[model samples]
Target chain A: MNALRNAALVAVVAVAIVLQAVVLRYVSVDGVVPNLALVLVVVVAVSRGSQFAAVFGFGAGLLLDLAPPADHVAGRWALALVVVGYLAGRVRQDARESPVASVLLVGAMSFVGTSVFALSGVLLQDGALPVDLTLRVLAISVLWDLMLAPFVVPPLLRLVDRLGSDEVAAARPVSLARTS
Target chain B: MRRRRFGQGPTHDGSRRVLGLLVLAALTVITLDARAGDGSPIDPARAAVGSLFGPVESTTAAVTRPFADAISSFRTNKSLRGDVATLAAENSRLRGEVSTDPLDRQRLAELDGLTRTAAETGYSLVGARVIAIGPVQSFTRSVTIDVGTSSGVTKNMTVLNNDGLVGRVVQATSSTATVLLIVDTESVVGARLGTNSEIGFLRGRGSIADSGRLDLELVDNAVVPSGGDVVVTWGSQNGVPYVAGIPIGRVESVVSSPRQSSRIAVIVPFVDFSALDVVGVVVPQGTTGDRPVISTPTGKADR
Candidate 1:
């Protein structure tokens, strides 16, 4: 069961990466595509807690870094997402309690993630995009992620809820039954 | 109950430690990649990931293409409507020209226009479809094509569409290669003015959203390129990265200031980098044996 759940998590992240790389290109606004993979990491963080989110974020981030057409340094996304995951996971309790908070957390973390990634680019001098353009990309991405958060977070959380229930019921029936 | 399983399973300090470890690992990887430069050890891992996900990306691109087409069509519906009259006029003119010219001559002319630079320069062209775009997180503008080393594509080969110069092949695997678009901030192409052949260097401004213009600075200060002047690639030594005489774009406007010695012209590129789909890779002359010939514009049957 644990192995199956882990596999499911990997599959979800992979699908998000693929969609971001492929499908999202068509829906881009002014050449700025939304960060679907970052949203997934936030969802994972809010639902699964810090340790799991960090590990998942690292794996997802590494995949994104190595993904084709990615000409930047290998670990830039990994570095940004690790911090994003840790921060989002720290607020997991608040996020779980209130849908609004979870959405807000996703929005906030989107900014952090985008900013971190852009800042890394500036530091490494990866691409010669001017500061204003970088900030413009940052603002647009945050808006994109913010608008996408509500649609993504709730459904994914519910799905994660259903996936967790099977394991939770088997592991600790007494506590889960009482809570329900 | 769910909270207990995850939150309480690992102590708070344990999770913090994990985060620190992951962050450190990421930093180490970044430093290693940066220091290694061209021969980075992470390249093999990157290639492995590319090969693994390349098929998935290609499949997804194929499946989602119609929807993408619909969305793009809807977005461009207004502009498309405006273009209808202009296209109609041009069509009639072309029809008149076709009737006046012999059928064979017209066909050759059409082929010549389609592969203008390649045909004129005698390059063998291998066409490929764009599979996926670069991740938005990276500021670099690049696209993955469906052809690779298997199709005789190698790094630094000039890529172009029917319109004009696209970019160059940066990395090539077995079945896919990444083309770094000419509009990327990091891209620099040696260019020459269409009129007097004044030499200049064109650098991308990296703004695909608004203007998508490139900055052209001539080596000689006195040469002033007027508006509407055309630009083409100044051939490299062996044409490894860029071939000569390929249409880049027309100079839209010139930026002249008293303090600056040389004239800076903003060129709007011929190829639309945003809407890249099918593009051709310029295969070298002698290496055309293995790959099936798509088009040999130079009138050569086989090299």
Candidate 2:
């Protein structure tokens, strides 16, 4: 059972990483590319509960930051993901009734999170992104999350439940293994 | 990396527990490396991953470029077609007309004389094409060009497009050379404002393409600056990286900053960089192999 659970978690995250890496303009609205990995992290974190979500989110963020173009502080992503994971864990049960609702919530959260990240980057660096580009990024990112939810959320939830009743407890050790 | 099994225990820190631990680890690394600048960029692990992914990104970009163009075409086909027609009409008109204005003819004559005089100087011109750019580059802009040391394009050579000064070559590999553009926040060049001949350093403020302005800080803001004012690089001791008069940019706007000694201006570059296919590289009189000179925003923070 533990082995199956571990494999399931690994596969989900591995797929997300590959998608983020290989795809460009995965969903385009106004020439902007939305970051789908962020959406996935939010969804998985919220639906699967916190423990698993935070760990997986941090791992994902670390990989995302490792990309050459990334300019954040070494663990900026880890910190962001950790917070998102915790936020997802604390979301009320009434709000996450349906997949579409969950996706919308996740997408909104991703947009806000990305804006915060951008602001943080600007404070650290000298240049500022134009106001329009910033807005476009948020809008397009939300659109992508909404568009990709059908594909991302159900499988994530199934995998989590299949892992065990201790949706939060069984999540840790297995995620760590896949991360390594 | 062994995973600790909590044995299905109920604990609130379930993930925060581990996250706190990771955060602690990351803080340790950041604190240790905050003072170490050079070591941060040379991380072998990070380099290996970036290199591995860079080519993949290139291939993807190459494949998607056509699609992107197609999308662009879809959005403004009519306006582009109209512009083409208007340009064709203007070209025909210029070919058919002969200007008889004495002042205009005299100005043309003087430009011709200046060109001839400039031609008398024996100088080598190296042409190159710009390639990719590092994503993280902002304040200290660096661009890769096709020309290299092999093509007589050495370090410290100035790069120019049809409009004005583009940048100076910093380093060269076998087939490629890196240039630090004038828009880089760190680059500072001696510049004269318009016909005023007011000399000051024109520094690169990095490209914020969306803003449609280049950051240029002048020595003084006391002089009234309106649009259409030209900025040129002031001649150095001996001709090399830049000649006596190369038009760099036009003043787009002038505004005051609360803390700085000078007022900053937005400079619109003469060259349309997006379509740049060729750049001229001029070898300065004495090239010191572009000694590890720091771009302003780069090394000074520590000092």
Model 2, runs deviating above 4 Å: A1-32, A46-49, A89-97, A122-180, B1-11, B25-34, B77-210, B223-226, B232-248, B257-261, B270-303
Q: What's model 1's lDDT at B235? A: 81
**Candidate with best lDDT:** 1
Off by over 4 Å in 1: A161-180, B1-10, B77-117, B257-260, B286-291, B297-303
Fnat per model, in the order given?
0.69, 0.15
Worst 10 residues of 2 chain B by lDDT: B294-303
The deviation in Å at residue B285 for candidate 1 is 2.1
Query: Residues A1-180, candidate 2, lDDT per residue (tens digit)?
Result: 777766666566545544343333222232234455566677666556667667767766665555433333444555566666656655613224455556666776676656655564465453345566556556655665566666666665555555644744365544323322
For candidate 1, give the lDDT of residue B184.
Answer: 87
